[model samples]
Target chain A: MSEAVEIPSGTLTVTRPIGVQFSWRKAIPWLLTGPLLLFMLAFYAVPVVAMLLRSVNDPTWTLAHFHALASDTVFFKVFSNTLYTAFTVTIGALLFGYPLALALVRTPRWAPVILIMILLPFWTSVLVRSYAWMVLMGRHGLINEALLALGTIERPFRILNTPLATQIAMIHILLPYMVLPIANALRQIDPSLPRASSGLGATPWGTFRQITLPLSMSGVAAGMLLVFVLALGFYITPAMLGGPREITLSMLIDLQVDQLNWAYAATLSAVLLATTLAIIGVFYRLPGVSNAFRMGAR
Target chain B: MRRFPSSKHFSRRTAMGLIGAGLAAPYVRPSYAQGAWPEQTSIPDILKGSGELRIATFGGTMQETQVKAYFEPFEKISGIKVRYFPGTSAPKVKAMVETGNVEWDVAQLSRGSIMNLQKQGEYFEKIDYSLIDDGVGKEFRFEYGIEMLVWAQVLAYRTDAFKGAVPKGWADFWDTAKFPGDRALLGTTGGGWPELEFALMAAGVPADKIYPIDIDKAFASYDKIKKSVVKWWDTGAIPIQLLTDREVSMTSVWNGRMAALQAAGVPADISWGQGLSKRDAWGIPKGAKNAANAMKFVAYSTMAIPQARVAWGIPYGSVNIKSNEFIPEARQAVLPSAPAIKSQLVNYDYDWWIENREAVIGRFNKWLLG
Candidate 1:
């Protein structure tokens, strides 16, 4: 090494070769990513852009479809109902999922068995699951049979075509999606921090509230976003279990498509897409949410 | 280092060129192409070698039995393979026809659906009248399609609910107090529109001058019975299920389905009086890959013997006059297109209904959503 002579005030000497730098290797990674970028552009981006164009243009730059949707009270009611249903289901999933995930993390030996139970419904088709719910909820179905046997009621209640039935089916379907992500996040947290807190005379609940909960906030946020977005787009369960009055945006889209009103369908789809994006944006902006999303990846 | 600017410019130019090509490629490729339909080809030569002639039909036990009865004998006699596809719909038919990669050599379609396809043009091949018998041709003639099966949409009521006070006409059906229980109707506005119109006529609108139907009046009539309707069924099976399960007191069901349900010991009865009978026809798609074989299959399917066999197996009536000769008089009475059943049946205005289907269905859906 050459000794540095201080001639100028703030001059530095470079010794490394330019070829062995970050910029050079960056090109290699980009080349590897090219196929995925192209795939996303072609399949995902193009179709979405096309759908947007279809929604607005529809052979001419007309707001007719949007006007129809906005003017119709049914549209607004359905839209609100979809959001409210999603909110309730997401909260339900989080409440049920967080405890189960904690139990899963605490008991390592029984984890696999419990996980299989959680994942079994996910493996089955949604249609089959909805039909199963139908059998359970129908007038002369299993639930009614049991209730009548217990002398609960003289006549079977109309439970099959109700919003409560829709909620039950949706929560059952979306629970695993929430639990799996949260459990993974909870598992990754360093055990010593909570242990350190407890060792310092912090009570068990106190340590959990101060350290565990804050750390697990990332997972909770992630699970909520996942479950919420999925719930917004659910079509089959609501249609099968819920009454005509419980039709969602997706069911409306189906109605439009079935009626051969493709333009109207496109418009409704765009609305759903916009709503999902807005929710995602809100999720991203929440305190420490972005950091949480990035934490486990690296 | 000195050549960097020139190389950069070259790279930029190449990138711009690639972007331009990528943007323009899809537009450059023509998506719509038209060619001669039913490519004139030898029928026997193409089908002679192929082991199976793939046939597509709506799936169910009835369709399955019909396929077995009709196609199996043909397969044995002609040494052709028979492939069956169930639950095919109009959109699937349109896609297959438009793409010109039709897997179905022959298909069954409702009269309204065939007319809808014909309106699109270039989706179906013109029927070759020469293949049909003259008597059958004169009796069940259509321009673009050959009639296969006929069925009536009639009132199927629970005997337990009616207690011998059965509904005779649309006015009686609308009389909720007299026939009080949950009623069921087909979900589609177009499908059940004619029956509803007939009901309106039975309520007092004259049949001969029932054109330009007052939709508002029709809905007003429907509203009286709407509250009593428990569900609107989308499939044939649903109405049968409704009647058999006693979920609804009464529903309009296909005559054949009602027969099948009755045979299965379901406490349901059908009234052929003032029933709306419709025909399902067979047609070859335009630009069909195997036109000759399709025609041969069409001819084979429409023959009296096969039609009678299909009727015997499925309980649906056939359009063939010869099929009437084959069935016993007792069984013939139940057949919707039989001379006796046909006399009592009201002919649906296929032309008017086909023309107004889109408009009627659109308004109906909006009303339903409301």
Candidate 2:
């Protein structure tokens, strides 16, 4: 330093050799990213782009389909109904799922058996499960028959082909999706934190509200996000169980496809995709949400 | 950053191109060979020889029994083997036709599909009038296909529930107060069209005047009965089960299904009065791989003897005049093609329905959703 040695101008500048050395490390990262990039470009991006193009650009590049979607009362009604149903089901699943998940986490010894019970219905085909619910909720179904035997009602209850039936079936089908994640999140939380909080003159309820819940928020959010996204695309359960008045966007899409109106179907699909993305975007913005969700091994 | 040479991309592209080429290679065969169309005489030759002839149908016990009774004997006599593929829906038929890799030579199609396809152009080979028995041909004639079986969509009721006060006809079916409790109807859009048409007729729209049905009026009538309709069954089995289990007091069920329920001692009875009878027909695809064999299969399936055998096993009344001779007089009353039942039954105007099917179904779905 004291000598103030004369430095070569080229040495001060980043040389080609240094650049090459730096790029060599970057090469492996690019190589690793290449397959994923190509996959996303081909499968995900291309299809989504094609769908969007089809929705607005008809044979002559007209927005007739989108206009139809906007102008039509049926479209708006069904779209709204689909969202309303998804939201309600998500809320219902969360309300019911959280308690069950909490219970499962606290359950000692027989937890695996309890977990199996939760997963049992998931093993069956959705179509079969829907049909099973149809029979169970039918006019002269088990519930009605039992009620009649008990002289609770004079007539058979008409529960089949109703929104109530649709919701019940959907909740039963989607409960596992919510439970597994929340349970996993709860199970991973250190018991010592809650114990330490309680030792500091905090009530069990307060400790749960402040510590356990905060820690479990990641799992809860993840489960909610998963269940809500999945609920948006539900077709079979609603179709089989729900009445005509309870028709969803999926049903409308199905009808359009069946009638060979692919353009309209594409439009509906695009709307569903957009709505789902918007939901995910909103979810990502919630405080502590990103970090809370970051804990789990997805 | 250094740009890497995309050898991986090139390899992938090359691999995809090779696969595409391999997939397209089989389709390079000449569209129409000089000897491709089986000579008209091959039908008789195939009938005489011993080989398997595949017959496709909308499969059920009824169709299965018919296949056994009709195709099995034909196989034994002609030494032709028989295979069955259940033709489930119109889309399935379209798929089979467009693919040109037909698994089933002869397929049974609903009258509506037959009319639609016929209007679309010659999907099936035109029948040889000379080969057909005049009496049999006259009875079971269609422009593009031959009638295979006839079944009535009749009012079925639980005898125990209805007692002696059974709903007689379409008018009675619409009357929920008199014949109360829950009702079941078909959930299919196709099924709804015929029901709405029948409802209009029951509301006193005449048979000949049934064309250009008032959609609003039909839906108004449907709305009245909609509340009483506890369930809309999608499959053939559900209506029968609903009646058998006493889940619903009444339902519109196919005659064969009702017969099956009655046979099972479910205390269910069907009314043929003013019943809408659907005629199922046999036809070959437009560019069928085995057109000659398909024709032979169709001809054999529609024959009077086979038709009679089919009628005897299944409740589907045969279109062939000779089938009546095989059926006992007491049992004939239950048959859709019987003189008494046929006299009261409304022969659906297939031409009008076919032309207006899409429009009518669209309106029906809108009404259903509303």
Candidate 3:
């Protein structure tokens, strides 16, 4: 109360420096993010840094561990195989997810139930879901038995432990990740835009093609990024549903850990992390991806 | 000012000193993980309050049997509270031994797993032979651990798949023309021994002379059936699933899984010929607070009475040879360690695996992808 003084004459007073405003502004974001930043630093960042350092520092400063990962043909194949699976799963997710997302937004009556159905598996453990997939895809499983009894085929179809089964199971697991985002983006689109286009004598297909599809591209990109990045680290589904040829980087990492080659395991993990980061970097560098996020912010 | 040598280090030193008196652990790291030994309460004083025993074991029907046959009795006799953690114990053993904060008093480790960890450092307490009887198999008794039981990696087939000819051995398993259907094989275990041994047997090497495996010939033999093999199962349960589902006509399955399948009325038949049989052991972690009680539990659990109970419940061959009289011969026919089957079954060379594992696994992993 005492500080509230009236200016006696035409004098002006500045109590704080200009930098204080900027500093206080900066502090708001930092304060908001402080817990997350500290958590990431301690749990994720520190362990990752240690793991990367260990790739070179294990057993008296040797690069042999990295060299082993880089030089081995098996590691290379598994690395490439991981990328292939991720790509396949992403495409498959997008193909199924795009229309499901469209239907989810369009169906006024069943949206809640559909959303719950899509999100249901999240509550179930991934291992349990993978096992369920195994039962459904196995030779004596429902599909094969039904087909055989119908006399559609002479022998049981080969589905279990195949690449196709891996892809199918992965798409089932990741469909919600793709669908929810696209549906949210689609819902955010102005309702009048498509109506306005149709009112201007544009055909239904034309209106959708011109107005709705372009607006949903951002959602598509988001869903793709989410599914593809998640798929790269997948192991249980692939291990359960795919053959030896389905060996990927994650499985290779597990094998190394079990082998008691902790140093080598760290090296493989670093390689996998770097590969994921590089993929994300390239994904960001692609045209329209950043634009999609900026557009979605509206 | 400094709280240097940890209590765990002190305990290890006490253990080492006691080794001459037949109280040392099976293995002790020359240097404590945290370094140095600090004076602490004597072992007895440490256990004065906590009579709790924590055992890490796998969950399934077998674990159920263990709870009824071993844990319940041990807790009853020793007046110790027992808690069970269900999972594979190797990785946990590794983590606890490295961090020096051991939670598990006892764990059931596979022969290959125990041997592999032993090579890295001394992790298990040395066995107190005075407490254990000589009835436990010599092959399974380790300096740090005692026999748990034995299981096999055996060739199993669907009876309906072949009407006339049955897959008798590894050679028949290799012949695609005679029994043409999808076949399943295991991918590399930590040691590539099973595949290498079987491949040698398939290539006409006698089971007795299969050791010192010619890696070249084994790979060549593996290459012959590579196209015919449809699934490379990663887990022991997968092959059993494969057989029961009829996904594959023939598969290499764990004897227990096969037994379970057969008992459940699946038309699955397991062949003992050229099969690989392995023993599992019960080991105490080095820094476990209740190591003495854990040892008592292990010794009692491996006795004929307990072993017989386990075999009767789960149908695995008991480690205690004396349990043989208790397990009926009819039931013994299905166990890998049965006297009738033991002569034909090949004992997996655990030492060779311990030394040659990394190199062999590297090659096998490459071949698997190829």
Candidate 4:
């Protein structure tokens, strides 16, 4: 039955009472996704599934590729190197980026300028940044020339092909990823909680320790995860800036694929994907990350 | 209204099935072949219309040289429009061939690529040798592909490195005490060919005595000089950059790249001595659209004059022996097939690569990690 009702928002309406009524027609808009889903299936899912399958079925079924990956010191060494690089880069970015992010939040007048400076590097091509690092790090590059001119270091030092160079370049490239998320999370604080804590005889350090730090954990965790994951899969920077000992998993995959060793390539890729998932799997189980996930799902 | 639950259950089942299908479709999907390719032997017949031919090539200056020598001439003669996709890789070709939805009408394939994909079976179309000119060598010709060009991985060094005496070959390149500067060399992980040959040669094995390569001695030689080596140049451009920048005074690089760098006044020079010369070929992927037109394109590109023109443009050698007659003698010096250069360069054994490259690269990567 229809009834005239005037209530919320100063509006009047005469409408049927709400009840359970479903129609297949309501879902018709969802059908529009058919082509896109098909496209993803055609271009994405198929190749990924096929590659995963190839890891096992390639050149006759055997876990030999996996065994090689497990037993071989090369694979193990690379795996550990990649993990180490990613972890180091993550920590480096957090230390550098967290302070920058705090400054960005505190000085509202300079926020845009600081943000532009941080994001300017982010917007530039990763390849360009890597090449820039090369110019700065080469044998007679600006750093060495400057050092020579300054009379600080007598010789042009070697830095470009070392793990240190890789770390520096990677941290530079990924700093913004860590900064933006943490800055956004910092911006979300009520500002009252800290004030109220300080008013109740709590010291600034104690207030930050109990309230602000715990609250920002989600962003920190997310930033670390993002930077770590990206660092693990890095190819161009490592290939361009780092030498043999710095070779990562993605580079290994590229090398294997170029050699037309498909099974080996697939295995490496599968392991990378599995490792990424495993890391995320462990991460999601953490209190801060699980909270972030639950919030994201909402 | 009363008949709803059963049909609703049926509808839900249908949706579940549809979602399952949408997800699973591409993985289990059979090849959906397109185009009506009637059998024909004559390449000219394939090109008699205003149809288009698609080619896959690695881009940058390589494609630029190819367009000048191959595409322009073929298009002008055949009245067919040429379309190209750059950075087409072997893995992409493998995916296309395996999926049976081939994209390119023809592809530029490296020796490793051809052997790798061909060994997998029916990945490439069998060539009709009749369409191509007879000038292409029998050794270079294949049932599935036609040799396109020859390039060598050669030794290069900064001209000022040795001052008075030049480093003669890989042996001198390895003798850091004699020449004395930071050096660069690629292990097998860097597409290990010429390096292996160089290693064997440095260990006192002659070029002729190189293959069925004594892996043990080569590695031992590698061990001797590994400490002196500053870096392993992974990409083709790195070696030249290293030499020009004086990061490494001596390094190994592709001959053509060194020529380009020298032309650009990089103050670097190459030695053709004991270079690892290899050939690259072009083939149509299985079930390609306008495949016949692709064959015609490959055929025209392999002709002596076209081959010579491409070689002259890029300084890589033409696969066709008769291309020498077409190329001027000044240009011949840079071409790997030039009598003087050819005498010095050792042809890379692709068959040996097929048999041993995997093990070599594996061991090489392990050695590098160690």
Docking class of 2: incorrect
* Per-residue accuracy of model 3 over A1-298 as CA lDDT, tens digit each: 1233446774864354443345766689899999999999999899779867878897789999877776889988888888898899999999999989998999989888888889898666565676688778887788888899999988787788789999998888889889977887788789899999999999989988999989888778878887888888877677668865787677677677677777887898888788778877877876556654544434
Error of 2 at A224 (Å): 2.8
Model 2 lDDT tens row, B116-220: 755644556676555565446464687667777888887888888755797777678888778777787765422334377667766877765766767677777
Q: Please, what is the whole-model Cα lDDT of each candidate in the order they appear?
A: 0.68, 0.67, 0.74, 0.75
**CAPRI tier for the interface of model 1:** incorrect
DockQ of model 3 vs. true complex: 0.27
DockQ of each: 0.09, 0.14, 0.27, 0.23
lDDT of 1 by residue, A1-298 (tens): 3345554765875454444445656688888999999999999999779867877797699999999888866667778889999999999999999998888888999999889989898887665576578668876788998999999999888676568888888888889878877777777779898999999999989997998788888778888998899898876566546653565777566555544456787898889989989988999887756655564532
On TM-score, the stronger of 1 and 2 is: 2
Q: Rank the candidates by TM-score, best first.
A: 3, 4, 2, 1
Which runs of model 4 end up more than 4 angstroms from their true locations?
A: A1-20, A23-46, A57-65, A197-210, A290-298, B1-50, B187-194
Tens-digit lDDT string for candidate 1 (B39-134): 112233323434456666755545655665567666655567677665444545666875667887667766677777677666778878777654
After best superposition, candidate 4 residue B223: deviation in angstroms?
1.0
RMSD of 4: 11.5
Best by lDDT: 4
Q: What is the TM-score of each candidate against the true structure?
A: 0.77, 0.79, 0.86, 0.85
RMSD of each: 12.6, 11.0, 10.5, 11.5
Of the true interface contacts, what fraction does each candidate have? 0.01, 0.11, 0.40, 0.39
